[model samples]
Target: MVVGSDGYPLPMARFFPNLAIALSRETFARIDAAETVTNLLSA
Candidate 1:
């Protein structure tokens, strides 16, 4: 359970359902690809 600053349990799904949906498998793959490219460039 996630707690808020007020010491109350926060409903993450209720508050950020859209954010959860936005992080789909395709989005994760794109993010992973970007990170891998950055790491290779910096190495």
Candidate 2:
């Protein structure tokens, strides 16, 4: 449901920032250990 400035659909990778935060939280949601993780967004 996301689009670019040109009105074209944006790829999933374009959501890296949101994805990274959601993923990291979900990854440790049920675990006791939490660690900082970095996500690199590249074309």
Candidate 3:
């Protein structure tokens, strides 16, 4: 379970920088492959 500020645990952002980094890597990889851009165009 995650808490917020004011003496609370952050949901993910604070406690999961590595997860964020992994997600970012995947996102960038997809972007570099033009997957995201293609989806944007299809939308």
Candidate 4:
């Protein structure tokens, strides 16, 4: 998950309880994979 300038994630965990907790490795891996794909596409 990304932590914004306020030391919180962009989605704002306080409002979205679903993403508040520490994400599992599998979830993080998925996000990383997506980011990589996005970056490749952008490049």
RMSD of each: 7.7, 13.0, 6.8, 12.2
TM-scores, all candidates, are 0.47, 0.35, 0.48, 0.47
Question: Which should have the higher TM-score, number 1 or number 2?
Answer: 1
Root-mean-square deviation of candidate 4: 12.2
Candidate 1 residue runs with Cα over 4 Å from true position: 1-23
- How many steric clashes between backbone atoms does each model show? 0, 0, 1, 0
Displacement of the residue 20 alpha carbon in candidate 1, Å: 9.5
How does residue 24 of candidate 3 score in lDDT?
94
Looking at model 1, how many pairs of residues clash? 0
- Residue-by-residue lDDT tens digits, candidate 4, 1-43: 7687788667566566655454666688899999999999999
For 1-43, candidate 2 gives per-residue lDDT tens digits of: 7898899998766777888888888877735333222222321
1-43 per-residue lDDT for model 1 (tens digits): 8898899999889788888887786799999999999999999
Q: Could you tell me which residue pairs clash in candidate 3?
A: 3-9
The lowest-lDDT stretch of 10 consecutive residues in candidate 1 is: 17-26
- Full ranking by TM-score: 3, 1, 4, 2
Tell me the TM-score of model 4: 0.47
Give the clashing residue pairs of candidate 1, or none.
none
